[model samples]
Target chain A: MHNIKIVLIQTFHPGNIGAAARAMKNMGLSNLVLVNPVDFPSDEATSRAGQATDVLENATVVSSLEEAVQDCQLVIGTSARDRTITLPALTSQQCGEKLVAEQQSGKVAVIFGRERMGLHNSDLKQCHFQLNIDANPEYPVLNISQAIQIVCYEVFKAGQKQYEPQIEAYPLNDDLNRFYDHLESSLTGSGFIKPSHPGQAIEHLRALFKRARPTSKELQILRGMLSSFDKE
Target chain B: MHNIKIVLIQTFHPGNIGAAARAMKNMGLSNLVLVNPVDFPSDEATSRAGQATDVLENATVVSSLEEAVQDCQLVIGTSARDRTITLPALTSQQCGEKLVAEQQSGKVAVIFGRERMGLHNSDLKQCHFQLNIDANPEYPVLNISQAIQIVCYEVFKAGQKQYEPQIEAYPLNDDLNRFYDHLESSLTGSGFIKPSHPGQAIEHLRALFKRARPTSKELQILRGMLSSFDKE
Candidate 1:
């Protein structure tokens, strides 16, 4: 999440740059470096950025991809097309995981190529590995912004997974069973489940509750509801 | 793949429609059904579609979710928010796998809701399950097109899994059904489940087996064990 820069090499559209910034911001990523963008500080870029002008305002503009990514310890070049060279190609997910793992060591850069031509083989040579997004084989090209959104999403997900909060334990089987018993009697009293045909109704109710795997608190609430229903 | 349909309900932006079409095409999916799109055939949509005009051109326009998915056997709704009623929630990956497995049985529809307001409670009721995309918790509000890209990518990946060598096949629904039937009858015959009150016992066993998701070979072994129990 920190010390990670997104480098756009030879970007042709100001709108894409803005959209890329917006995408990065959506994933809680802020650092952006533009290499030889056709236009900077344009109205179109700002308008597309919507409320994410801070990212656009803070973006660093550089002359070349090398200059933009020089500080990065890990450089990943994104390519839509397959190349003749046998460089290790990683999916967007794999790239994100690798970036998160290596981010603590130093700065990491995910470099996106130009709109039409993408990154040249020479530019790709600077990368340790190529990141290839698995897209529809029929029309595999993704908008630059769309690609950024996906890659940033992966990185964000990886970081989030590392800090995922532990969930409370599910209710024990005995608690669930007791809740079910209370529910059955309440429903039968309410005429929702006829005494003679309660077996099928109770089974379906059990199935529904089992699928939910409610927490201990939720089970208590459900039992309370049944008691209220019984009183009614 | 042939019978899968992407249903967009009340899409607000024409540009998002175009982007979604591009995303679908990028993943080798073309069946697009729009339910009450704000604007179609707009210049912005076409422009965003880039080379994916075929998907946009051949897209079907429907009035309601019922109409769009009436013929489909499996309907999956995508929801960013958790609901009060617990539906069987599947991750994008799991949704893809289930869709692929059931595609041969009938048409499968993956429905996306509007930009600002997602599908209503009634709309969700029509779905067999819900697909929740893992996104940045800070900004989980993904652009509609970005969600489409992630989902289509998952489906494409699941399709690719069939050709991926050495992975044992998961038991198909039909195979699981046969195994469940055998299990129930054997349990009844073995006195584990009393014949008169077998409903709840069979339902619990079914739930347990479904959660286990035994592979094809494992199903066969279970059926063999049931046969042995029947003999005893």
Candidate 2:
């Protein structure tokens, strides 16, 4: 099984946190990261966790989404609502397969947003891809824990390793973010993206790089090229 | 899409029923049938259903599994436990594909058992095959509604219909049950199976017939043969 982490952001109900823990543990996933949860160590969460309270006890609480998935090589955001800016979208099954294949290299994080609003545009921008659980067109808003269950179930299915293939290790989210920062500064310094009117160019660049998923060595080479541009 | 029915047999939790309804609606499956559910029209179930109250409102409540699936051509039972009397087992994906392909003929019922105990052996006997949702071997017991969600999701995925063959209509569960009764009594009358020592003969016969899945016309022909033996 892959070392998969379940990240819940700004969760309102502690019960959902507990239920999500149970869902993760039900699929052999242990790591649970919470970003700005409303309540922790609540009776409701503990009670809802049933026999899987250990998952809650050991869960990491972080202040931001970056901290939650900083060390992860692959970050996937679950979105219930359609966004104007399209990220590379994959069904839950595809996400699972990709996550499993990628897990051979490093850690992977599947992030879920708030109970009511789901993942914000800013949060989704940090993800390599968005996962949409193919739900009813009429009532697409699935419960957070239920969504967790679906994703975890898919991962567990893929964990059987029937489609296992060794793939190249992608850089961690932290490395990717750093590269994005370098790329942005280099673009501004090179007068490619005017500081005064960058427009949506940076956003488009981020999406393009996310899709490309440059490896660590590739990122280093790109950074060296940016350094050459900076010196010029 | 297949005309799929989600059946909950002897369900103890009204909230689960409501959640199951929401799960079904989330997957574009509306038909809900309850076989002796402990509570219906309860606040918990309605609250859990969220925006899918129409599913609950239109759900069919029945006294027995026979009544619940009598009109259905394909009856599949979901089981977590492996039984000594082995029935053809299919993962949720295979079951989904088969159900979707079989949907061209008639109604299909995917029955879920009680919350704590799951389906009784007698209940499993009624199904043509068993559907198992792959989960953690350490904790394979998924919540009732969660199981419903997984199965419904697979069916929804299979609903895309890559394999749409128009198969001949098979007899309903009611007709099949009636034929089994007729065959049993006729066997006793013909001295083939004595009422005193029937043993597992009827069960073996049931498994045989379930696999054979005789069509309505074939059932009528078999019934006629039994009637002739009765006259002799």
Candidate 3:
């Protein structure tokens, strides 16, 4: 559970951070990372954290979402709106099992975006799977801390059950991002993608590759093929 | 489920009432009976309810705990402490599944005790099952609304109307096979795949892409990438 980092991106409230810490600790999770929080070391957050203040004390703070999940093999972004057709989605239960299983191999991240606005398209692009919590459509919005509680609860439940550790050595997030960058450049140089057109063609390509979730060796092969195209 | 009710007993916080209403609405539960809430129709509660203000507006305010569950056939009490041994205890997951199934026959209720003091022995006698949310023993007590959120989330999941965020249209086998042919020739044209080594390299690449099951649009992107390589 320690390898499963709960990454919060640009959180608006200090209280939510405290509540999130409490939730994570209650679920037997210890890792907590904050990306550009509005306020930290606040009284309000500490007060809400209860006896789980230890989780808040040891939290890692970073400047960007990319920095928070750089070493992770799987980055799961939670989204309220269903926008990214490119990324595969996981239910909360599936997300819990996936996180627990993947954590055995390497660090895995479940990212929570800003309270007011959800994940930016760029941040969404970084995620391997989009975690969607099932709720009533009429009022699907759950408070940020509450959302964290539900996810952590599911994680705790999953942790209690036995799981076979994931055997696949997946490419890390940094490497995956670099590969996407190389892909875009190579496609542009080959005239398969136009600068003016920008995204649809590239987005489709990115989605295809992401949905596939290439293994490290497969990623290497794809990269080598792209490099050869670059030479031409 | 309309037949399912969330009965909060002697709630002290005005904010939690609103939070409970939002949690109930989010989980598709509409019946909320507050047993002698310290504050009713408070601004804090209304604000916390978000789009679920309707649930709060329609909440049943009662004088006593007995009155709240008088009409309900089944009552399940939630407790922070595991004290009741006489009755069957259900994990939160089981509680949700049980509630959903039992609601079909008649009315069912899940009870939450006060913030500071949990359910009394007298209250425990009224409930058929005691609901327990499994958490780290060090910080087992959750925020009132957070507990409600977990229970409601499980109930919503038990309802079995999960959402599919992305409905991908995968490529047909014939189209996928044709794209594999194009990919092999393109890699060979670019000299990334040596023709003399034959099918081994192509075979591995095919297995990777086939496992990915790229959508029809992605297959088109692949084909276009191959076309660009042919030009190179």
Candidate 4:
């Protein structure tokens, strides 16, 4: 993740730079390259960064986006999907996965443009792919840090593709059946269910519980409460 | 879509509320609810909200999480996995799919807790599930608004999937709350709840019912059944 650079071009809001740094750090990416930011080393950026001031402190400031990503094997620029500039585009998910997969081989970058106007044509040309974040066409423009956030989140997920399998323990059929039986008997005792006329109420409850797929501990709690009700 | 609510609880930063509004709007989510914010109607929030100031303007301010999501059927809280509270959990992807699929039936919510402390145990109990955005374990915390960005992105993607709702519309939070109230009263009448010594029993039941997420018709049956118990 460190090999991938988050390059921002002439960012007008220092807070965005700070937010972007925080976004990158939260996702485990540390390389930050700023291309002629309007303001750098500002208190606003530092204040917005929360705990990620280290990323900003270590940032590499360059004169141009070209110079920032010059040594990178791949560069992905973010833009609205319907922009006039035409280029091979990667969705934010694709950008994240690709960067994580390919970052080890060489330096890589995912660049973001200025706040109001996105990347210029020249900036887009320097990229191997334009990254399109999924959004409503009516208002596709995303705040710069928010755009970085989506991209960074994707990268984080892709990098952890082999995350440890879930360790949650679900109830066995016997316990679940016991729970259902206890539930039915208790409800019958409480007059919530009648003995002779079983209807769809239990079925609906069953279906809803089935979808939830309770863990073993949760099932125990359910059974324990029902047993207490029976004692009453 | 319009039925989805983005609820923020007691946010200390007004800028975050604004950024959250922008994040929600960027992904076509409009509903924003604030539960006892430290500051609102501030220039900082509006300035940060960008063109999404309308979302902030139309935001609902409530005193409690219970009030904020009273009308929502399914409520999801955003939190790290290592919290003291436990609930049925969903990844950001699943949270998106579930909310989109079930939203047509009743209002749904995705909640964010305070910036420093995250959601409280009381808050977690109100939720059927918790949303954990994948991130570096060493530093999994994301800016409140940035987390909103990722969740909304997944939601936007899921919406684009053009999913057909297979499940029946669920009951509104108001009806669900009423059913709970009736259940609690009936249980108390049955000596199921000791007034001086209420423990995890009711909360666990609330969590269970929330997980089941009964439909309006199903809730009616449950409530009707509870009424019978009261009569008995």
Give candidate 2's whole-model lDDT: 0.82
lDDT of 1 by residue, A1-232 (tens): 7588999987888988988887887778889999889989899899777567899999999998888878889999999998988479999889989988899899999999999999899898889989999887667789998899878878876777454465556777888878888876755565556676654656645664565566675565556434533443
Instruction: Fill in the DockQ of model 1.
Output: 0.18
Query: Candidate 2, residues B64-153: lDDT per residue as tens digits?
Result: 998888888888999989988768999999988888888888898899999889999989877999988887777777888888988988
Clashing pairs in 2: none
Sort candidate 4 into its docking category. medium
| Superior by lDDT: candidate 3 or candidate 4 | 3
Candidate 3: list runs displaced more than 4 Å. Answer: B161-167
Q: Could you tell me the lDDT of residue A85 within candidate 1?
A: 83
Local distance difference test scores for all models? 0.77, 0.82, 0.87, 0.85
Model 2 regions lying over 4 Å from their true place? A163-167, B161-232
Tens-place lDDT per residue, model 3, A1-232, is 7999999988988988998998888888889999999999899889989788999999999998889999999999998897846478798999998998888889999999898897899898889999888888877878888889999998888888998867778999999989999999998998988898866887887777887888998899889989988998
Off by over 4 Å in 1: A162-209, A212-232, B82-88, B163-232
Interface RMSD of each: 12.3, 30.1, 1.3, 2.6
Q: List the residue pairs that clash in candidate 4.
A: none
Best by DockQ: 3
* Off by more than 4 A, model 4: A81-85, A163-169, A187-193, B224-232
What DockQ does each listed candidate score? 0.18, 0.14, 0.75, 0.60
Between candidates 2 and 4, the DockQ winner = 4
- Candidate 2: deviation at residue B198, Å? 87
Interface RMSD, Å, model 1: 12.3
Could you tell me which residue pairs clash in candidate 1?
A136-B26, A136-B27
lDDT of 1 by residue, B1-232 (tens): 8678999999998999999999888888889999999999799999999999889999999898878887765678999897755356688878878777777656888999998898887687556678887765555666788788878877887887763233545553445556767766655555556677654545544433444445565566556444533543
**Clashing residue pairs, backbone N/CA/C < 3 A, model 3:** none
